[model samples]
Each structure stands twice: as C-alpha cells, then as structure tokens.
Target: MLPASASQLLNPTDVGREFLRLLPIALFVIVFGIAFGLASVQAGLTDWQAILMSVTVFAGASQFATLELWGQHVSLLPLVAVVFAINARHILMGAALYPMLRELPAGRRYGILFLLTDANWAVASQDYQNGRQNLSVILGGGLVLWLAWVAGTVFGVTFGGLVANPEQYGLDMVLGCFLLSMVLGGKRSPRVLLIWTVAGLSAVAAYWWLPPHTHVIVGALAGGVLGYCWKERRHGG
Candidate 1:
C-alpha cells in the first residue's frame, strides 16, 4: 500500500487540461515522427510498413535504431536484444511510479502505463516530486503525443519530403527543453541537487565506459539507490 499522499486519483477535467497543456510538445513530436517516417522509407520499409511501425511500436528512438538493422532477413534474437537494451530505462521509470500506479485498478493502471513516454513521464514524475499527483498527464499528454506521431508519419509517407531538415529548425531540442523546464520548476533543495549531480556524473561515466544503451538505466538506478538510502525528512520532522 502507498502512503496517503502518494495515492493519485484520476480526474477527467485534469486530464483534459493536461492534454491541452501538452499540445505544443505534441506539435514538436510530429516533426520527430516525420523524420522517422522518412528515415524508415530510406531504410527499405514501405510507406505502410513505416506507418504501421509508428502506430504499433510508438517508440521513436528504438524504431529508428531498428531501422539500422532492417534488411531482407533480420535476426530475431538480436532485434529483441537491441530493443530491450534501448528501452530498459522504462523499467526504472515504471518502478518510480509504482506507488501511485498501485492505487488504481490493475486494468486502468496498465492501460495508463501503455501511454507512458519520455515527455509525460517527465511531467508526472516532476509533479510528484513537488508533492502533486498528476497521472492525468500520462494519459492525456500521451494520447496527444501518440496521435501527433501517427499523423506526422502519415504526412511524411504521403508527401515524402516536406521536412528535409528537422534539426535545422531545432525541433530535436524541444523535448530536452521541456524536460529542463520541468526540472527547473521543481523544489531545488540540497538533497535534490546532490541526487541530480550523482545521477548526471554516473550517466556520463556509463556513457564513456559501459556498453551501449546502458547509461540511462545505470544512472537511474544510481539515483534511486541514493534516494532510498538518504530519505528526506518531512517538514517539521
């Protein structure tokens, strides 16, 4: 059972608001999706196949990475390993949200988790750290982002050359900026700062020395362990 304060109740109005709040980010995601669509086509995937992958897989980075391995006959075991290694950080992200997720019915909980992505997870986790329960962002923001991605893929497939250079427009930085804003909005205590410093240093070290696709999970687990060992004292405690 979660602590009383950790229990998150879903509200329809809040969900709607979060959907609107994330609209700008969704627009940027469309650009990324367009890039992926074009890349997939160049990688020997048909238009339909690319769009279907976008709709079904819905993981842009992993999808792009898989494109590099696409061929007449891809090795199943290697593909699965690559995808798992790339997405292993999701395990830590889901675990971090488990307390709030446990409050919901299992079906609803898993349903919402299906929509979990980097942007909405950043928002929800930051809000939670700031003493707010905002699972609405996961559902609502995720829906908009998913739709934008699919729609952009369709556009790219149909037109095929609308966006030649998404990077030139700085579209790639949109999510990074959004996440930075979320982190900056949070309470900046010494404990939080220390945890962030440790996490950042660990991520850098892992990037330099560890195998590919392991940095995110390594840094996340390092920070999680630090937080567990040095629990914050509640106000007036």
Candidate 2:
C-alpha cells in the first residue's frame, strides 16, 4: 500500500520529465524491437503486419512467442492460450497499481494502462516503494517506449532481409535468452522461486506428454494457482 501522503497527481510537467528520464532505456527497447521485427518477417508476416502487431499488442515477449507458432498449423485455442499465459502477468501488475489508478478518472486510468510496459512499471513500482508516487512514468515513459518499439520495427522490417539466416547468427535463440534473462533478473523470493519451480516442471511435463503447445497453459496455471494459494507472509504489522 502507498503512504497516505503519496500524491496521485498526473500533471503534464511531471509526465514530460518522466518521458525524458525513460528515453535512455527506450533506446535499448528499440534493439529488442528490431530483433522481433526480423523474427516476425521470418515467421511469414509482412512489414506492416509486424508493425501493427507491435502497435496493438505492445507486449514484446508475447509477440515473440506468437512468432514461434505462426507458420505452423496451430489451433486458435492453444495460440490464444499461449499468448494469454505469457501476458497474464499484466493482470497482477494492474492490480498492484490499482491504488494509484483509483484516484484518476476512468479515461485517464485506462489510457495510462494502455501504455504500461515492464520498464515503466518498474520505475513506478520502485518509486512507490520509496514512498513516492510516479504515475507519470506510466503515461509518458510508456509513450516513448511505444514509439521506440515502432521505430525499431521499421528499421528491422526494412533491413531484416539482409540477415538471410537468423539461425546461423543465433537470432533464433533471442526469445529464449530474453525470457531467461527476465526470470533471472526478477525478484527471487522463496515464494517466487517455488512458483517458478512448479511452473517449469509443469511445462516440461506438458511438453513431453500433452498435446503440442499446451505446455504454456499448464505452466502458467500451475504457477498462478500456487502463487494464489501460498500467499506471502508480511514482515511487519
């Protein structure tokens, strides 16, 4: 919970300041977006299609995963499930920000959420923990990141054909490496570790035994259920 004195104001000045602060990080995001654009092309999407996906979805990890099954004769149910499982973390993220969001009008609240990404969320979460409120990052920082992603996609789409063999250059492994980095970089409390362990094992089992593409659903549900049932203990009263 935020401190009672924490401000919920969402003024233009603060929004502009946060936008500039996040610009540096958005540069890195552009690189990742470039990678995704190349991969999307290789997976059979046109330049405009890839760009539109990035614009509408705005979820990098899920977009990359979608590329994995793009050319295959995959079921829509499983495809949708996989995307949902990958992006489900947004639900919890939104819940965490509900306190600050509640103070805003519905239009502003949902508008800010439309631009929410991991980087901006981290900025806001860290500030909240330090007894500060920073919703500006959610709106302004998010806009910059979105633009960076779109810009990177444009570059990749234009030059992606140069890299004829993404596999030869190990570009094929980028998604796996990126997801692993996220896991390793995140908080590793015991509860989180346990949930991840269960999720990992479930995914492996589903891969070996269940129908193709079901591992993601199995793993996500396993982890989500465990996290819900085994609540974390609060440290102080």
- For lDDT, the strongest prediction is 1
lDDT of 2 by residue, 65-93 (tens): 88878775767986798788677767767
Q: Give the top-scoring candidate (TM-score).
A: 1
Q: TM-scores across all candidates? A: 0.93, 0.70
Q: What is the lDDT of candidate 1?
A: 0.86
Error of 1 at 43 (Å): 0.3
Q: Following a full C-alpha superposition, what root-mean-square deviation does model 2 have from the true structure?
A: 4.8
Judged by lDDT against the true structure, how good is candidate 2? Answer: 0.80
TM-score of 2: 0.70
Each prediction's total of clashing residue pairs, residues at least 3 apart in sequence or on different chains, is: 0, 0
Least lDDT summed over 10 consecutive residues: which range in candidate 1?
A: 1-10
